[model samples]
Target: MVPTMVLVADDSQDTDRKEALRDLADAVAERGEAPVVRAFGSGSEVRRAVHSVEGPMVVVPAFVAGGDFASAQLFAGLDLEGRFDACPTAPLGAVPSMVADLAGRLSASGWTDGDGVVLAADGSTGQDERQAVTDVARMLSRRLGSPVQVGYLNSWAPSVGDAVERLQRNGRERVAVAAWRLVEDRDYDRLHEMGAASVTAPLWPSEIVVDSLLAQHRAAKARLAA
Candidate 1:
């Protein structure tokens, strides 16, 4: 087996963010498969770490969806000028398992068909990124047998507050906001101000998430071997 390094590139300077990624790294190691390193801070920092590795590597963004920072932009800043051994899978949110996690979170919170849901994600400037969040919302909609709206914490239209108001206008008084983030940030805090009856936690520290990360790593390794 090739010595693979699991890289987590995150932009947040918060201590909790670093700790959470470290916890995730611990979880990855617990799988008894590959060695893990928890590098946090910036894309460049992660890039420098990746550049030191001499074998197959999988850089999995610790993000739920592909926001501008988590997608190509993050990797673009890396010093991988000629490195082809490192591979990146899609953002964790795009995987189908996350939809199940979101559904389960909402259902566990007493959400019903009569209730409304707003898929809350951090703001991103790219329309493609916004669509990714929307796609996750639609998947949740299908799972719960109801409609789910998309909302952002920073960039784009249809803020969580706006979604909540719209749902209330549509006669759905009970509204919940499903967190489409990996860790809590200022954006996660804004969920309460949106007037949601309930807000779910970010997708992390779950068996489903660990499974998703492992799956992405395997796929990327396969791609590299091919």
Candidate 2:
């Protein structure tokens, strides 16, 4: 079977963005589906491609920092509902579902109870970003059947390392960290340096989730495949 193709749109040409998209593409491909990953350097480019793509395509926005509003507007401007199934960059409401999905992935990856923590940061300084983190943490905790704390790297609160230390000091056996922000090489290196494991949520690209966008993309993909 031919795998689904997902288009990744971002304004920056940075390495972090590229890696995140690749990770997502790999995840989709691992589902036994084909994926054609396309990167856009601007919203205009993304908008244009949205019209040109022939099949179902997941539009992943590269706006990780503070451009969510603009990204949201661009997605909205495309009137995706009229033409395609759009899955926006992030979908926090799907955190519970994502947590369930993560549980399986973590278990497969050798994660055990009380051994991992979900780490997320609101790098965009947007109110929704913080809420998204909290939502994912809550869902993960529920799904894991234990308390899973969330920490922000950019906040005044304890850093990722500090969070790990606290968990270790409290006698947690294995500790893993998950972030919603762009998983840059430095970020991954830092997680390794801190002795914490990390995983990124598939639904919340860049730690943000816009449900309408996700629905659109999913619908478009289904329509094309059908």
Candidate 3:
């Protein structure tokens, strides 16, 4: 087992978002049966946290819609190379388990057959990350036995409002949004305002999220062992 684990996230300037991430991290650590250190933001905090743990420590990127590539870029900016024994794992968005979670959330939010579904995420400028979001949306669509449109909170087209409007135009009376963000940010708030009949809570502090983290941790350990 890695002696220590760190749940890392890109710094959200909002305190509420930061607290949400911290709470999610704690939940993941508890459910994953490991003590996890919550590290947000860039610079000294990340550096110190990385240095505090030695020898192939597990690092979970608390980000959605971006995988290892995004993590690599963020860590590189933090100068995380050779600082400690760190094994970076895939971001939460890359996990297939999230599809199940989304399904459950949508269903719980009063989603029904024939209702339009939209997977909403904070849009990314990076093509790979945007594609990752689309991939997840497709996976969810498959599970729901319905097609799901992709919408962005920012930096992209086809906003959630646009999706709802499109679905409404097509005669779908009920529309629901499955949130892809871990915290309630501007995007999260915007989803509610977009006039979706229902919007899921942030995709964190849930059993599915914990399972995904464990899956990512196990995969990273296997890769290291191999």
Candidate 4:
């Protein structure tokens, strides 16, 4: 077994962006996942600078469907670089606690019975990823006690706008959008423009992600040690 590595950030991505993830990764290496790291400030921003890295070793994926592609690309890059022992944390979607996190955001957004739901995802090319999104939607639906519709921001049919509009056309007003990505991004801004009554925030800056990252990292690392 290889040594397990926690993914707080995808160093494989742009040089910037994930100072917190990388910092948490480093903290996980030395201390633990959540020990008042020097990096985390206000639980919202990173106080320190993120040093540059050569390549991606582990990706703390934002969401499963989109993380799949980024992780694959990073894995391939590792192969090309001759670093084969790299490991990454499972996608946030794989973390059961995330379901609660999703539900929390929905509730905060005032989602209730008779209001339409659109589980908006970043979209992916893999069928498995699509299934993963659907599975999450199903979970959310059960939690909400109502039907949930899936809408892709890119890649597949039934766009977010279309889904929202479809619900509106059906006379179900007050549509809420649950963005399943890791962090809030520009892509989600348009949801409000589309007249979503509420758009749930991403998964980061929450205890669920922090706790999930720690658990998944320990499990993977334990496997390697075994």
CA RMSD per model (angstroms): 2.2, 7.0, 2.9, 6.4
Q: In candidate 1, which residue pairs clash?
A: 64-93
lDDT of 2 by residue, 1-226 (tens): 3324444445344566566655654554454434555545466776666666665456555433322333334544554676444444452333454456556655665667768575544334455655666676677777778777665554535666777778888888677766444335344444556666645433334222333334445555565567
Model 2 poorest ten-residue lDDT run: 204-213
Worst 10-residue lDDT window for candidate 4 reads 43-52
Worst 10 residues of 3 by lDDT: 66-75
In angstroms, the error of model 1 at 168 is: 1.5
Rank candidates by lDDT, best first.
3, 1, 4, 2
Task: Report the poorest 10 consecutive residues by lDDT, candidate 1.
Answer: 66-75
lDDT of 3 by residue, 15-87 (tens): 6667777788877766656668877766567767766775667777777753223333565465557744567
Candidate 2 global Cα RMSD: 7.0
* Per-residue lDDT of candidate 4, residues 56-121 (tens digit): 233344345543344323322322134344344445563567877888899898998899999888
TM-score of 4: 0.73
TM-score for each model: 0.89, 0.56, 0.85, 0.73
lDDT of 1 at 143: 81
lDDT, model 2, position 61:
50
Better of 1 and 3 by lDDT: 3
Clashes of each: 1, 21, 0, 2
- Which residue pairs come into collision in candidate 4? 4-221, 8-21
lDDT for model 2 comes to 0.53
Candidate no. 1 TM-score? 0.89
- Winning candidate number (TM-score): 1
